[model samples]
Target chain A: MRKFAALLYKDLLLLVRDKAGLLFLFAMPMVLVLVMTGIQDGAVENSSKKTVSVLILDKDRDEMGREIISELQRQDLFDVTLADSTQTASEVQQAVKEGSFLIGVYIPENISSMVRNEIESSLSEMLGLGSTPQTDTLSSLKVFIDPTVNNTFRTTMMCYLREASNHIEKKALLSTISETAQEFSPFPTDSMAPPPDLKPISIDEIAYSKDAFRTNINVTEHNVPAWTLFAIFFIVISLSGGIIKERQDGSFSRLMAMTCPYSTYLMSKIVVYECVCVLQFLLVMMMGKLLFPLVGLPVFSMHGAFALCLMIVFFCALAAIGIGLTLGTFASTHQQASVLGAVTVVVLSAVGGIWVPTFLMPPFLKAVSVLSPLNWGIEAFYNVILRDGGIRSVLPNCLLLLALTVACTAVSIVAKKKI
Target chain B: MATTILRIEKLRKTYPNGNKEVLTGLDLTIGQGEIYGFLGPNGAGKTTTVNILAGLLKQDSGNIEIFGKPVASDRKNTMRRVGFVPQSIAIYPELTAYENLSVFGSVYGISRPELTNRIGKLLDLFGLEKFRDKKAASFSGGMKRSLNLMVGILHNPDLLILDEPTVGIDVQSKVVILEYLKTLNSHGTTILYTSHDMEEAEHLCTRVGIIDGGKLVAADSPEALARRFPECHDLKSVYLELTGKELRTMED
Candidate 1:
């Protein structure tokens, strides 16, 4: 055990001196979390483009056009304004050109007559009563815009036109069918009166609740914290270069010549790597708490967050040590071990959702994620932070991580013997 | 019957590729505190012999007894009493000389106080006390070699096995190392050294064994080998007379 302590001390000393490994394992991941979280918040905020002002020119005085105007006003995306009849193509163009409004819609004077004609034509075609429908009612609703408005305005206009066309079609169908049917003499006048204005569908605008809040929280909040946990594991794999260095240098054989057993040396490595990983985990979590809120995540409870983080760090440390042992056994040189170590970590992290979200992945990829420790770690973080889950909720992931640690450690020991 | 520090009998090793025989029916013995030199041309099986004795490589057929205990029966205990300084620089270059010594000493199960004392003594002996805090990587070839040797001896094993210890060092470094080995010998440590330097073997070894074609050609005190070859005055002449001057190179 004393011998192992010495070995562990030496490994820690080497790790302190190797700046490249330190940066790759600890600093780089922290930086990545900061950058990724910032970008994610930016994307979410950009997607929610609040209120857009719309100019409306209603040439038709019919009730259908009036109904369409009222409907446009109801949607929160648009702030609709009616334009006078005197407003010409140039005047409307100037208003859009001056950037007073984001979009403009001009309803033609013959719109109601056009709807009537379209319904008749469609009925004639379906009944084989006349030739095919003549007018393109759907095509005429297209708005002419100042091309400078670009695709955003074009897309919004297309959406608006589509909604209007649907309403027109429904209203026309009701009018046409009722004209052909008998008058509604069976129902009493009081009974025929329209039902009291049904309340508008109440949409809860609350982006998050205390219980379901985590799902609505931006990726930066969950991903950065989770990545910090992953970074600690990565550090373990990276620092394993010390073992390979000792082996290549013949220092390990020389050590074997002494009273120390292979078990002591191997155990020391596991201990030192676990310590480093845990340290990294704590540092990054602290940094996340301090820095990530600027990217839009709410302040999280530190006690539960850290407790979950510690469990992940422990698991990662074991995995790292196991990987180091495996590499030490198989690698002929420090360079070989370092390269393989780096490659394994990168590939594992990619599959584990460190680089990408598992939810966005295909079903097969999600299933494949089960094989990676990162998936369990992220799941654990989600439960803790999003679900407000306590120890019981995270217990399953913690157990799996512990199992991985044991399995990896056993394989590492067996591999060490072979070496 | 003075307790034999090392004993090998009927040791045979064959490479799987090309059916090459590296060692065939080799037998030898060394008593305590003896500086035994194993001399051979390249590929005469000097390294293979050392590797087998060190338990780093398993021999196909052999019986090795160290301190009256069968090597295979209790390999770990046998290894503990032996220190091997390999041909390569086994110390981590990134570590300081003192740090390397401490790690190696710890691996040997030395107590902290003992390790601290051993490191200081080794640094002073190797004339590396001033560079104790400097990383081994920045040291010259000779300094690195000296530190490497120091790391091997930090545990103070009873039997020290050095494989080409002076292979790639300057004359000054080699002299310091050889002088240190002599000091260790005077303190009753048994040493088995392998080297191609005939003069070094003549000066340092109490007895020298010349091997050729994986077989022992001569085994006796350096003076005895020289006296037996009437035409030979120096150890080099004795070596050439026995193993021939032809270069032996193997195709891997």
Candidate 2:
């Protein structure tokens, strides 16, 4: 035990004395986290959530006009501001043209009456109680938008208005039916109501909105753990490079000359790196889960996130050490160790969904990503950080990481024997 | 009658490729407190012999005993009592002189205070007291060599095996190292030294063995070996007379 502690302490002291290495170890990952998060958030903010502000002019000042604006605001996708009582349709359009809002709309008087009249006449003709209804020439609603506005936005605004008009027609029909039944019976009969098209496609939209919200992934949750683990796993390069230097320069012989079992030396290497890796894990997590809120990202509850992170990071360190030791043992030169170490970590990080989400990857690459250990690690992080998963949710990822550690460490032992 | 410190009988080895044999039925012995010199032409297998004796290599067929412990049966016990100075500098360059000594001493299982004491003593003995805290990376070649030798013997082993410890160094540094070896031998330490410097070997060795083509061609006092060859002026000529005038180069 004394021998083991001495060797471990010596290596750690040597690493700490290297100012450049220490700087990279502590500063590089923090900087990468901030940069990557900023970049990802930039893409997310730009590509999604096209929030539009609308200036609404309600000339009718009726229930139908209020319902349209209320429904738009209820979706939480638009900022709906009512026009002043004195503002005209031209004033609303001018406000939109002057860059006050992305969209402008006017609801003139008698537009609600026109929709109600159309529904009643159509229902009466369908029932053969009157002649075929004449289609009205009066426009019901007029919208003005910036010419630079995209067609998608135009289509979205048209859909909202169409739905709002349909809802008002249904409400007017229901009220007329109730009045007719009040004259004859106690309850409104189904025959008194208008056609089936007046009914909504869905009576309840709350459930849909709840699910639609999940479509937007929080970039911070995904970026924090993915890049943090990516940086931590890169210990393979530094660890392997250090060991290969000692081996090439014949300093390793000094340890062998002392009758110090090579196994003990290998263990000390693992211990020292594990210590460093765990410390790195804590430092990175502090900035990720703790300080993420400063940048408008929600600070996920630390309750279960800590254990999930610790478990995965521990095995990740072990697996990283295993890779480093195996490569250091097999490589005949310092360059071989460094190049192989760097390439392996880089390739693993790419396929493991660190840089790009697997869900967004092409089919074949996504299928092959499962073979990467980093894939399992990043997946485990995603489950806890983004998916609101618990300990049981990440069991498979944790077990895979541990299995990789065992297999890699075993192979490294075999390789070390040749040395 | 000096007690025997190393005894080898019928030791043999061959390369894995089987193109050439490294050691063939070689035999030798060294007594306690003896400064034994090992001499050979190129490819004479002096290094192979030293490697096997130091327990770094396993001999295919042999019985090797160091201080009555069979090296093949008890590798750790024998190696713990042996100190080796490889031809290359093996000390950690990134470590301070004191740190290097402490690392080796601790692994040898020396207690903390004793290891500390030994580091101080060895640093002074090598006249590196002022540079104790300095890293070995910036040290001169001779200072590194001296520190390299110090790390080997820091555990105070009974038998020290030095393989060309003075290959590249200044004359004054070489003299300091040689005088220190003489001092160590006088204090009841057995030394096994291999070098290409014939004059140094002729004066320093109590007994010298010359090997050629994996065979022990000569083993006797330097004066005795020189006397046998009347045509030679010294051990240098005697070495040439015994080994041959032909170059012993192997094809790459």
Q: Candidate 2, residues B1-252: lDDT per residue as tens digits? A: 599998888889886666888888888889999998999887888888887776556678978889977876777878888989888898778789988888878888889999999888888988999999999988999999999899889888899999989989999889989999999999988999998899999988988989887768898889998888888789999998888888777421
Docking class of 1: medium
- Each prediction's whole-model lDDT (CA): 0.75, 0.80
Query: How far off is residue A183 in model 1, in Å?
Result: 3.8
True contacts kept of 2: 0.56
User: CAPRI band of model 2?
Assistant: acceptable
Quote the lDDT for B237 in model 1: 98
Q: Per-residue lDDT of A243-278 in model 1, one digit per residue for the tens? A: 667776677766665535777777877777777777
